[model samples]
Target: MSTTNKLLAGAAILVAAYAGSSWYVGKKAEAEINHQVNEINAAIATQLALSLGEGEIKLNVVDYDRGWFSSKVNYEIRIKSAKDEQFQFLAQDHLRHGPFPFAAIAKGHIAPLLAYSDAKLLPTKETQPLFDAAKGEEPLRAHSFISFGGATKTVIDLAAIDYRDEDGNQVLMAKSEGQVDYVRKGGKEQADFTMTFPSLSLVVDEGDLHVQLNGMRANGSITEQDKAQASEGELHIDQLGINVENSTQIFIENIKTASSYEVKDGLLDSTLTYDFGKILADKQDLGQMQLDVGVKRLDYVMLNQLSQVDDLDSMDEDELLPMIKQILVNKPEVYINNFMLSNPAGSSTLTSDVRFATTALDPVENEELDLGHYVESLNADIRLSRQMIKGYFSGENMISSMADMFFNSAAEEAQEAGLVEYDGNEAKLALSFDAATNKLLLNNKPISVEELVQILFSMQMGGGLF
Candidate 1:
């Protein structure tokens, strides 16, 4: 062979060897990236535990394939409290690009998903269960929030979480940009959302949904498809505000607030209102509370997430009762400036203002009246302000006996004792709190607050004599 031919053959071999080496490196890099993702997720689980320190965390991590050259890593962190409540959080998605030696990393375009499930623990002995749960549901959340930088954003929501269909579709969908805390679980366009499961065609379904829209609030709104589930506890920002239909989705429209969490009476409350799009719904069930609930009448959930209530621990049972009493005033207010809920069943809209009042809740009385027990003092009045209350007699009884009053408060007494007379829908209801007997009387008869109390004081001083 001539020198030129030999040189060509040698060059070809060298080129082939370089190509083989590159293939090996690329394959190993892919494996390493995947392995790293798993490791990152493992670390996240420990890093997100409620008692945050060096290694107590929870996470929902998903491995995404951007392309042969690039990959997207998405996931969320979920911290939990003792109650069956979750604190949601968003973690940065780790996006890796290019060949190993010159790989690149980028952050997500829209904020990543971060939230926990509407669940709680069973008091297991395990130190952490979210790590296991996070891995299981990370994929579902990934499909829930994935946008590759588009002009017009898309929103998909999943309501009717508790109801299911025959075709195995249980998640009801309402779409929009970001998520509104309250979706129309009872709307007309009720559709099941399962992007991961493509076989099920869109179908109409039956479920309880409350969809509200004010002509002024939802007129210029555009809706996207809402189909996402976070099995693992992670928060997804893809769906913010009620982009769908029912968005009294009032969030922190223009207020700057920090993030925090509160646990009370065995319930966990998330207290952060992020950006202008944060879903800060007032939970009627888990109303405003703080770790130091005994000391102050401050709301620890929304406006006061960062507020450190004074004398949290030093408060005694005496101090704490009043504070807890204060929570009753902040019950959820559903004000329909202009409301509309349209669907197959029916729809109604009207302007209304509902105020949550803590008028009279004697915590001292409540604590003593636990279980099926209640102390009652019945003060029957005669003609309470033309309300025509017949008799001005009072009696005290146990809840067991009190329940009799609910059914037969005056049935037998009215017949046997001939206390009062006559009535048909004029039935009234009031529980006269008994400080001594801890009893409550069900007045299906006419009565006044002042007359009722007077009867009670008279009974304490011995019925007829006082």
Candidate 2:
């Protein structure tokens, strides 16, 4: 054959091979879709059981039309809430079989893959309102790149919304987008995702109310480990503003939250932190505040079973009390690692640690619950800066005046009762409890339980003054 003919022949052979592989990949993609549906259903069942029949969810592949190099799939999702309210959603997917799908190649994705899918939520009678809110656009759209190695990278987009009513009420939402990368192997799964929303606003002309939130972002990761799940996440908002009648305005800046959960030695540990960077009311600075709280040594097994209880309200008290006792006997610890507020004047701080006893209790023998028997030890400290308190309550506002008076009265009463110790620039309270010695101390001064209870009761009755 001539050189030109030989080149054409080689090209034809390559095309044929590509065509064959594309068909094979299309078939495999269809099978994988079915397998994933089964997995989803299994997960829904497990969740339902664990939530004690809180809700029901099921996903079904209603149709799959497989072509030589592409396929169209339809899916239906049914959800029944704990309140028995039912909702149905439909999704349509266009899958291009790959080894080198045309769409992927167009995007310069050359590596081999099983398929690329473009999916969109379809409108139904129940979802018409959602569609209308999106100005007739689909509420959600997602694109997925599926790899032969059972991993998927997906990009999801949520449509922006602009809605108004005859009553002069309006709501506007900016488009939100997210990406998820997920993989499951050998009975373990991992997923990471990040999402962003530019802004959301609601306005009520009649009430002169306007609420605006801007620059919201969230990122998270979940991983399965040894039949357990560990996860961590953070959420942040650049600013949140609320204005009422142009007179009362509250603004919060850089609101952030972080949380984590993990398992260690068959026990669960978790921590959560919140930071409100700057809070302002009517343009007056209200300082910044943060809280960090954590729990350790939680009996994962007992808690897991407790979570799976079919129905708590209907369960016999005889059976439920013991389960709770068993959980408390595991000696879990709770910590308020840091609770702080800072401003130009000064700072206030509070910290606490409480632990439960490991000793088991017989509910049958002890008809009435005594918290002292289960509380192993407790330690808490509070330091209030006098300057900070004065600065915070010095605003020329009715609310501030009331708060100032209340704080002054409470401080005087507490100091007189020897519950709070005052230093040069701060007021301090240190409380500790020991179950072994049945001792309670306030400001390093021993106090009887009865006396402490009476003081607390007095505070409660006398408008929260000690």
Please report the candidate that would top lDDT against the real structure. Answer: 2
**Residue-level lDDT tens digits of model 1 in 178-199:** 2212122322111122122111
Task: Give the Cα error of residue 127 in candidate 2, in Å.
Answer: 2.4
Name the runs in model 1 displaced over 4 angstroms: 1-69, 74-76, 83-315, 318-409, 412-426, 429-450, 454-466
**Candidate 1, after superposition: displacement of residue 325 in Å?**
7.6
**Backbone clash count, each prediction separately:** 42, 0
Candidate no. 2 TM-score: 0.84
User: Lowest summed lDDT over 10 consecutive residues: which window, candidate 1?
Assistant: 284-293
Per-residue error (Å), model 2, residue 374: 1.8
Residue 378 CA error for candidate 1 (Å)? 19
Candidate 2 per-residue lDDT, tens place, 1-466, comes to 9999999999999999988999999999998788767755754564444334666688999999999889999999998776678999999999999988888778778889999999999989877777889987778999888899768898999999887878999888999999988798888877788999999999998559999999999998877667676778899999999999989999999999998887656677888999999989888788999999998877666666665564668879888877767767668899999999987778899999999875546433555544466678999999987667666765656765676566666777777667787655677899999887888898899987678777877767766554
- Listed in order, each prediction's TM-score against the native is 0.26, 0.84
